[model samples]
Target: MRILLTNDDGFYARGLQTLWQVLAEDETFDVSTVAPENQKSATGHSITLNEPIFVTEQQKKGHKGFAVRGNPADCVKLALQGELIPRPDLVISGINNGPNLGTDVFYSGTVSAAMEGVLLGIPSIAVSLAGYNGDDYEDAARFVHHFLKQNNFIEGGLLNINIPPLPANEWKGVKFTKLGKAVYNNVFEHRLDPRGRSYFWQAGSLAPETDPETDLYALQQEYVSITPMHSDLTDYRKLKI
Candidate 1:
């Protein structure tokens, strides 16, 4: 299988690196990566329009890939439209540093990258580890590798996968889930720069999940969550009414 890998956590992120290493080691898979040169988390599906997008060739763990000076969506766009890499059989964006469960997918560059692939008529997946401040991504990466080898991908399909931070043996197993409500207690800390200019840093804490069938609840229960997604956002129920 020909695979294109990407992430919002930048080219040098351990999560991406571990995933790259795992995928590249497989003889049956041809893998290429094009990721943001710097952290582009929460960038969503935004692409660079007015500015020139730059790409640099980089190597990690003995694997060569491109580093884009743009957002995650831009990386996939350029890689596909510009022919930066050969037309891939699949696009996998992540093994992200943190979970992109529920409504967080709306703001997630990781998921956005995968969505871009789906829009371009390719099968895609976005995988994340359900914790921040954790550097171990072996279990997540291995799961992704196994997932790719076991499943047959269809065009226009996108899967948003979230893995718990525990070892594989500790996992309750994988669950097919739906998006949960991600209610955040948002805060913007007002501050002044050294030049006396005002600025605010955005922060928030997520509320606990209560829905059993949701991705968020699956992670809380130590199960890997797989939520199938699509590009359309139409309210079909309302439309039918």
Candidate 2:
């Protein structure tokens, strides 16, 4: 299988590195990476159309990749437009440094990379480890590899996989979940720089209204949550009105 790997956490992120190491071990996978040169978390689906984007070639062991001087979505766009590798059979984003649950997906560059692949008619998945402080990706990467090994990629859309920050044994099981209502407590701390210019830092905590079956709740209970995502934003249910 030919695979394109990417992440919002940039080319040097530990999560992406771990995923690359794990996937490279599989002889069946012809893997390539095209990811951001710097962290672009919470960039959403923005594209760099007005400015020229750049790519730098990188090598590790015998594997080769590119670092994009743009957003996560730009990496995927460049990969396809430039034919960076053989037409990818699958596009896998992340094993992200943090969770992308519920409404968090709206601001996720990781998910946006996978969505770009899906828009181009490729099977894609966005994987995230649901803790900011966790460093172990052994189980998370294993699960992702196993999932692709056991199941055929379903095209036309993408899967959003969020793994709990725990050992495999601690997991309750995998759950196909729905997006939940997770909104942060919006706060902006205003400050002044040495030049006396005003600045603000956006910060908040998750304040989601959870249901047991939703992705937010599933992650809380140590279950792997897989939510199907699509590029279409239309609310089909309202079409009849």
Candidate 3:
């Protein structure tokens, strides 16, 4: 299968490249990498608008890689619409340096990139290894690969996968989960630079609500967490209410 990979951590992120190497070695997947030229973390689904999106091609080890001057969503959108790769069979985003769970998805560029794929009628998945805790990213990549092998990508949507930071032996295996509640612990932090300029930053830890069947709990219990996501903004819950 032809797979299109993108990420929010920029084209040169350690996790992004490592994932590319693992997937590229497998004959089962024809991997293509296209990503933002720089980090676009926490950008959500924002795309380049009112401006042109730039794409520069790089061929490596007989593989195609594109560095785009835009957000993760923009890269995917442009690639699909611009006929960059004919038609990609699947879209995989991340191996992101951090977790994307519950409310955090609202601001996650990794999840957003995958959402863009789903919107374009392609099957997609977003993955993150324990940047929060300590864990084996290589093992996480294997498990995600197995999932693709097992499931036919008949269902086109985004699957958010979060791997725990524990060693593989200590992990509790995989768990299909729902988004869990996680909010900022503190409002934020503002500091002044040497030039005497003030800046505000979003700095906080995970909030304190625990749902046993949620992605958050799965991570806490050292299990690989997988949650399907989507681009549809319609609140089904709100419609019911």
Candidate 4:
């Protein structure tokens, strides 16, 4: 199988590199990487249509990689259009340095990157390791390999897997969970720069969670959270008659 790998944390991120190293070692599949040149976290599903998007070859230890001058979704978009890798059997985004749980999916470039693959009618997954300074990618990568080995993917959807940063033996095992609520108390903070210009940045803490079966609560419990997220964001249950 040919796997098209992409990530939101720029091309040089360690988490993506760890995933690259892990996936490339599997001789059962061929791997190629295409990712944003700069950080595109929380960039949603933005695609670069008007801009002249191009792909240039990058060589590392005789391995081929592509540095996309666009968002994570743009990289996948360009790849499907014959810019980077050819038609792929699967598209895997991330091994993101942080958790993408609950309402975080609404603004996640990692999930958006995977959703781009869904748009191309290919199976996709967005894998993320909890925390920013995690040194562990084994369980997450293992879970991915096992998941693909065990089941078939949904046709027009993607899976969002958030692995807690814990040793394999310490993991509470994987759970197919639902998205949790994200209550943000302080959405922004005002600050002044050296030049005395006022700017506001997104800075908020997750409020206390209410459900353990949800992704956010599961992560806090040291459980690997797997949510089969669809491209559709519709509230079908709320439709009026």
Candidate 5:
């Protein structure tokens, strides 16, 4: 399989690196990476249209890849449309540092990169480890590799996967789930900048998961959540009206 890997956490992130190493170990897989030069978390599907996107060939920590000075979507776009890499059989965006569950997919750069692949007529997957402070991505990376080996890629399909922050043995297995509400208690803190200029810092805390069949709940129960996603935002139920 020819696989293209990307993430919103930059090319140097541990999650991406771990996944790259794991996937490269498989003799049947041909893996290439093109990722952001800097962290582009929660950037959504925005692409660089006006400015020139800079790309550098980089080799770090025994991994070789292209680092683009752009968002996650831009990396995938350039890789697919430009001559950065060969056309891939599959696109895998992440092994992200944090979870992209529920409605977080709408603003997740990790998911957006995968969505870009789907839009370009390739199968894609977005994988995230459901924790912010956790640094261990070995299990998640291994799971992703195993998943690829076990399943055949569907053309133009997209899947959003979230792994619970637990050891492999402790996992409750995988669950096919639906997107759930991700409510946040938002706040804007007013503060003064260095020049005494007023600024507002946006922040929020996510509400606890309650739905049993949702991605959030799957993660909460230590199960790997796999939710099939698509670019269509149409509310088909309302079409009859």
Candidate 6:
């Protein structure tokens, strides 16, 4: 199958590199990669229509990919136009450097890349390792390969998978969980620059949620979290007359 690979963590990110290495080793899969030239984490679904976007050729031994001077969504968008690669049967974004759980999806460039693929009528997935300090990508990459091998992906939606940053043997298995509630208590600490100019630094901490069915809670329990996502943002309950 033709698979388009991209990530918000840029072309050189270890997470993306690990995924590319794993997928490219499979002889049955045809993989093409297009990713940001620099990290574009939390960029959401922003597209670059106003400015000219550029793609640079990059190679990892035998595999060749393109690095786009834009966000994760832009990589998918430009790649789909048939400039860099053929239209893919599947699009897989990330193995993100950090987790994309709960409301974090709203601001995630990883999820947004997959969302853009779904918008173009392709089956997609956003995979993330749940910790920033993770050193192993084996479990996560293998999990993605197994998921695609075992399941049939229908068009029109994407899956968000967040793996606990643990070895395969230590994991508590997988859970299809809902988006969790993780609201941050944000604080803008005002400060003066060297020039005596006013500035602010934003900081926050996650507020806990008790729901066990949520992705956040699943992660806390050491389980891999899988949450299905779609483009529709409608609040259907409110539409009831």
On residues 50-100, what C-alpha lDDT tens digit does candidate 4 reach at each position? 888666677666566998889898898888886556788899998898989
Q: Estimated TM-score per prediction?
A: 0.96, 0.96, 0.92, 0.92, 0.97, 0.96
Per-residue alpha-carbon lDDT of candidate 3 for residues 173-238, written as tens digits (9 for 90 to 100): 889999887866776778899999999987677766578899988888888898977666797898
Backbone clashes in model 3, listed as residue pairs: 134-165
Q: Which stretches of candidate 2 lie over 4 Å from their true place?
A: none
- 2 against 4, candidate with superior TM-score: 2
User: What is the per-residue lDDT of model 1 for residues 65-133, given as tens digits with 9 covering 90 to 100?
Assistant: 999999999999999999999999999998899999999999999999999999999999999998887
lDDT of 2 at 180: 89
What lDDT would candidate 3 get against the real structure?
Answer: 0.85
Find the number of clashing residue pairs for candidate 4: 0
lDDT per prediction?
0.94, 0.91, 0.85, 0.84, 0.94, 0.91
Q: Candidate 1 lDDT (Cα, whole model)?
A: 0.94
Q: What is the lDDT of residue 219 in candidate 5?
A: 88
What residue pairs clash in candidate 2, if any at all? none
Clashes per prediction? 0, 0, 1, 0, 0, 0
TM-score of 2: 0.96
Q: Whole-model lDDT for model 5 versus the true structure?
A: 0.94
The predictions' CA RMSDs to the true structure, in order, are 1.2, 1.3, 2.0, 1.8, 1.1, 1.2
Report the lDDT tens digits of candidate 2 across residue range 41-80.
9999899989999999987776589999999999998898
lDDT of 2 at 161: 98
**Whole-model lDDT for model 4 versus the true structure?**
0.84
